[model samples]
Target: MVTVPELEGTFIEVETLVEEADLSEGPAAVRGVLAELNISEDAFTTEQYTDAVIAHRSA
Candidate 1:
């Protein structure tokens, strides 16, 4: 996995490829996998890497 320069740490990204019509199911599916991996919902981040990088540079 590539390190996120802005965040200064490598991150894990879990994704579910649901169709646009089924977009609502994406989060629940990913959450299930994360739960299995022992990752709690409280640690989940919705911020994209590009957004993080921009914010870091702006700061």
Candidate 2:
């Protein structure tokens, strides 16, 4: 499961994968999670979000 840690100045988002699912299911899952969180698609790049998650965990 994916865990997106909270960032002080940014929205937190994450994508988790289940062994039974395929990669194609990722986008829709991400979109649904983002929608639920009210995050706009253009607000953060995949790379940026990834970095934030890493930084938060390491901190």
Best by lDDT: 1
For model 2, the superposed segments whose C-alpha errors exceed 4 Å read 1-8, 48-59
lDDT of each: 0.86, 0.70
User: Could you report the Cα RMSD, in angstroms, for every candidate shown?
Assistant: 2.2, 6.1
Report how far residue 20 has shifted in candidate 1, in Å: 6.5
Model 1, 1-59: lDDT tens digits are 46875588667889789999999999899999999988888878888889989999999
Number of the top TM-score candidate: 1
| Residues 8-54 of candidate 2: C-alpha lDDT, one tens digit per residue | 55446576785565877878888889888888888656567568778
Q: Model 1: runs farther than 4 Å from truth?
A: 19-24
Which RMSD does model 2 reach against the true structure? 6.1
